[model samples]
Target: LGRIQIKKTDGTLILNSLNASDSNASIKGLEFDKSLIKYQMYYSGNAECNDKGYVYLFFPDPNNLNQMKLTFMQEPDIIVSCPSGYKTL
Candidate 1:
C-alpha cells in the first residue's frame, strides 16, 4: 500500500510508502522531490526518452528502502496535440 500527499498551492506532491496491511514498512517520514525525475530526464544520466516508450520511477519507504516490489499495470493513454502553429520542438 502507498500514500499520497499533494500541496494545493504549487501542485507539489509527496508520496509515502505506508501500505494497508504492511506493518513493517515505514519511511521515518522520508520524502522525495518531483525534481528528482525531471533532473534524471534532463541532466542525470539515469533516464532516457524515446519517440514512443515507457518511463518508470520508483521509491521505497525509508524504513524499507532496501526492500522492493515490482508490479505492472495498464494505464490509460494520454494524448496532446498542438493548436494552430504551436510546435513541441
Candidate 2:
C-alpha cells in the first residue's frame, strides 16, 4: 500500500502519516509524475505520535514516480509556506 516513510537526520525510517490518497490526490499523483522533478524541498505538518512533527522532501529521480523519500523532523517546526498549488515534491 502507498505510505509516507518518514526518515530522520540520522538515517532512520518511521511511519509518520498513514493517509491514503484521496480521489483527487490519486489523479494529481499521476500528473505529478508527468512533470519534471526540478527541485529539493520539504513540507511540514503535525506529528503522528510523541514526536514533535515532521518534514517530507522529494527524493529526486529522472522520470521515476517511485523515487521519493522522507526525512522526519523530531521537532517539525514550520520552515516556510508555499502557494496554493505549489508543491514541495
Q: Which candidate is the best by lDDT?
A: 2
Per residue, candidate 2 scores C-alpha lDDT tens digits across 39-69 of 3223233223222333334656646778765
lDDT of 1 by residue, 9-35 (tens): 776544333342344322112233475
Candidate 2 runs further than 4 Å off: 1-50, 76-89
The residue pairs found clashing in candidate 1 are 27-62
Q: lDDT of each model, Cα atoms only?
A: 0.30, 0.40
What are the clashing pairs of model 2? 7-72
Candidate with top TM-score is: 2
User: What are the runs in model 1 whose C-alpha is more than 4 Å off?
Assistant: 1-57, 71-73, 77-89
Quote each prediction's TM-score.
0.19, 0.28
How many clashing residue pairs, candidate 2? 1
